[model samples]
Target: MTLAHEMAFASPQITAYAVEATEYPDLARRYRVTGVPKTVVNEHIEILGGLPEDAFIEQALG
Candidate 1:
């Protein structure tokens, strides 16, 4: 969540959304989200679970 917030702060090009899986079943299904704290970057990059900051950033931005 912090990374999402930081991305929002660091770049105007990025848009961050937080959604409840139960409420947005279609979205959850689309992303194959089976757990909490999943991050879908640019609608393609799927980073599952909590990660160390550096590792998360690498997967997210790389």
Candidate 2:
């Protein structure tokens, strides 16, 4: 989550959002979130679990 915020800060093209599954049940359900720390990029790239910064950026931007 910190990385996401950092990336967003570093680049204006990037936007990051942090949503609590428990707080937004409908949103979580729509995203098919099954675990914490899930990252959905462009509404398609579903990264589940914590990842190293490089790997996370690769998957997110690649």
Candidate 3:
């Protein structure tokens, strides 16, 4: 799904927060993010690897 579509259905008005690994070394360590494709959503939902567009959005939205 497109980011636009995800935004369309998102609650709490939908927001995306992005932080570079270097910017938050502590968080990176806690999350065990060693690769480039890791994705963590809301700090609770950790998607360890890349996924298809639809699947990624589904997880984030949930």
Q: Say which candidate scores most in TM-score.
A: 2
Candidate 2 regions off by >4 Å? none
Estimate TM-scores for all models. 0.86, 0.95, 0.60
lDDT comparing candidate 3 with the true structure: 0.68
lDDT of 2 by residue, 1-62 (tens): 99889999999999999888999999999999989999999999888899999999999997
Task: Name the weakest run of 10 consecutive residues (lDDT summed) in model 3.
Answer: 1-10
| Model 1 weakest 10-residue run by lDDT | 1-10
lDDT of 3 by residue, 1-62 (tens): 24434554676676655557888899789988897556666678876565777777788768
Clashes of 2: 0
Off by over 4 Å in 1: none
Q: In model 3, where do residues sit more than 4 Å from their true spots?
A: 1-12
TM-score of 2: 0.95
What's the ranking of the predictions by lDDT, best on top?
2, 1, 3
Instruction: Between candidates 1 and 3, name the one with more favorable lDDT.
Output: 1
Question: What shift in Å separates residue 26 of candidate 3 from its native position after superposition?
Answer: 1.1
